[model samples]
Target: MIFTVQIKVMPLKDLLDPQGKAVMGGLQNLGLNNVSDVRIGKHIDLQIEAENREAAIATAEEAAKKLLANPVMEVYEITVS
Candidate 1:
C-alpha cells in the first residue's frame, strides 16, 4: 500500500529563529504591528510504500530524524495518511 506523509521541521522553541524574526521586522515596517512571535518552518510531503499505516508512520519518523531535522537544535512532527 501507498501512504502519504507530511513532515514539519522547525527549530526548537528555546532556539532563536533569525529568519522568522526578520520577517516579523519586515511586517512591522509594513505597518502590521499586530503580528507577533512569527516562526518559520519546513514542510515536506512524500508518498511512501509500506505494509500498513504504522509502518508508514515509523518510516516517516525515521526519515525525519535522520535527514529532515537536525535532531539536536530542531524538532519534527510527522503525519501519515
Candidate 2:
C-alpha cells in the first residue's frame, strides 16, 4: 500500500528565527500593523509505501528525526493518510 505523508518542520519556540523576524519587519514597513508576528517553517510531502498507516507514520518519524528536522533548534510533526 501507498500512503500520503505530510511533514511540518518549524523552529523551536525558544529559538530565534531570523527569517521570520525579517519578514515581520518587512510587513510592518508595508503598513501591515495588524500582523503581530511571523514564523517560517518547512512543509514536506512524501508518498510512502507501507503495509499500514502505522508503518507509514513510523517511517516518516524516523525520516524527520534523522534528516528533516534539526532536533537542537527545530521540531517536526508528521501526518499520514
TM-score for each predicted model, relative to the true structure: 0.95, 0.95
Screening candidate 2 with a backbone cut-off below 3 angstroms (N, C-alpha, C), the clashing residue pairs are: none
Q: What is the per-residue lDDT of model 2 for residues 1-81, given as tens digits with 9 covering 90 to 100? A: 999999999999999999999999999999999997699999999999999999999999999999999999999999875
The superposed Cα distance between candidate 2 and the true structure at residue 19, in angstroms, equals 0.5
Go through the candidates in order and give each one's C-alpha lDDT: 0.93, 0.94
Worst 10 residues of 2 by lDDT: 72-81
Residue 29 of model 1, lDDT score: 100
lDDT of 1 by residue, 1-81 (tens): 999999999989999999999999999999999999999999999999999999999999889977889988889998875
Which candidate leads the pack in lDDT?
2
Candidate 1 local distance difference test against the native: 0.93
Return the lDDT, model 1, position 30: 100
